[model samples]
Target: MRSDRRTQLLRRGRNVECASLVYNIIEVAVSLTAGFATGSSALISWGVDSIVEGNSAAFMVWRLHGEAAGISEREVLKRKKTALGVLSAAFSIAVVFILYEAISKFISGETASLSWWGIGILLVSLVVNPLLAWGKYRYGKLTDSPTLKYDAIDTIICEYQTIVVLVGIAFVQWKGWWWADPVAALLIVPYVAWEAFHAGRDAYQVDLDASVSG
Candidate 1:
């Protein structure tokens, strides 16, 4: 019975990760295309972040599958630390890109132009992210997988950022506040930094645990 339950949990975790992979692929392609077409650096950076998050999801699938294949939990935990390290670096890159763009736009007094396609893409993401996050959260709890829970939180943050971007674009279109776009994009930087710090901290803690265990 215990073995059966473990198998079931692993299966669910795989399904969730696979779904996330597919979603992120679509998100990256669509968002980047839209960002370029609309000249929205915020959107471009968000798409890049999607690629990073997708890498983490891929690692989750690998880790969960390895455990199901009888690999030691400690080994899996070490790989997770590596994955989180990569994710932290990705977040740092994303922050740098976003800040650069935001500053450039602010200094140049250039407003980011939006398009119907971009707005449509953002709307789709607004819907998809919450649902994806909920699914990951539920499965993470069921399987007691902190990695999945962390990914779900990341997805939630992405969803919130989507809303921020959408609102920024909307305000710019409706009120002619060219600065709204950069201001909104800047608002997300603190959250991005917070996540990056936590990712690094989590990786560090995992490393300490592994060292002590060794």
Candidate 2:
């Protein structure tokens, strides 16, 4: 009975991870291209957010599979921490670039080209992200998998972050307040940093078998 429950939870994790991977891949391509062409900070931030989402998905694949395989403590800990380190670095770099571009674009008074594709990506993310997050979160609860849970939280955060970015984009497109996009994009940096920092801390705790949460 106990074994069956764990197996079911891991299966659910895999399903959610697969879904996340597909969505992230599609969003990244569109948002990155659109952001660069339009010089829109909000679009760019969403692009970065997509990358993070993809990373989370990739992490989920490993975690879900590891759980399925009944991963050893030492190996799981090492893999989890390594993933966290790499992901945190990627996020930090993105924040730096987003802040720099947002400021530069605002000061230069350049208007980003608004496209329907950007809006479409935002809409897709709004639905897909929450769905994925909820799926992973529930399974994580059942099995007590921190990695799975964190990935879901990251997904949800991406959803919120994207919405915030879109709001900025809307203001720019509607009111021509170019600065609002950048400011709003900048506002999310602190929260992203906080999430990344906590992820790192959790990763470091792996050696102690904190992955089991007991």
Candidate 3:
């Protein structure tokens, strides 16, 4: 690829990451507030996931910025590995937190109240996250950036979680199924764990490749 085009793609990736960071920050505040008020385990897990997403976006911003500044391939790989490691750890933590919250709610026979605010935020995310993921995926492919691709996957996961949480909320509100909220939160765990495993494995592989080449 041409140097100018590469630079442009990197710049665009950085911008996408920045946008994701900003969105996740707002999402965290609103989701957490609504989750707590309504006692929705699924919503609370969504808020926690937003925190992880925000951190991932911050890491991508740094990694993309370094690459755009003409960093060496080895240095870039190192940054990617470090960012992946952090993301892997963050995802694992989110899984644990979600499991704990969901299980406790299940055991306690707790039910969440309906929150129009939570529903509105999730509806907005259903629209916004897909656009962000598309931009990230497109730029990541153009630039051959594994970090951005993984971030895109994370964004897509958030979209899936949004759908699950919304469905759970609907069941609770309409069908009087109090178990739906925690069950919905639990449903997100396997996918998240799968990504966490891949991120950690990729990070290790990157480190090994760097060692062999160095």
Q: What is the TM-score of each candidate against the true structure?
A: 0.90, 0.91, 0.93
Per-residue lDDT for 1-214 in model 2, tens only?
Answer: 2386777778778888988888898998998888887887778877887887788788767766775777666566666777787777777777787778788877898777797888888888898888889998888888787777878778887878888988888888899887887887787788777866876776666564544441
Predicted candidate 3 versus true structure: per-residue lDDT over 93-181, tens digit per residue: 99999999999998999889988888999999999999999999999999877668878988998899999999999999999999999
Residue-wise lDDT of candidate 1 within 126-196, one digit each (tens)? 88888888988887888777777888998899888888888888888899898887777787788778878
Q: Model 3 clash tally?
A: 0
Better of 1 and 2 by TM-score: 2
Which candidate has the highest TM-score of all?
3
Better of 2 and 3 by lDDT: 3
Candidate 3 local Cα displacement, residue 170, angstroms: 0.3
Model 2 clash pairs are: none
Q: Candidate 1: count the clashes.
A: 0
Note the Cα lDDT for every prediction shown: 0.79, 0.78, 0.89
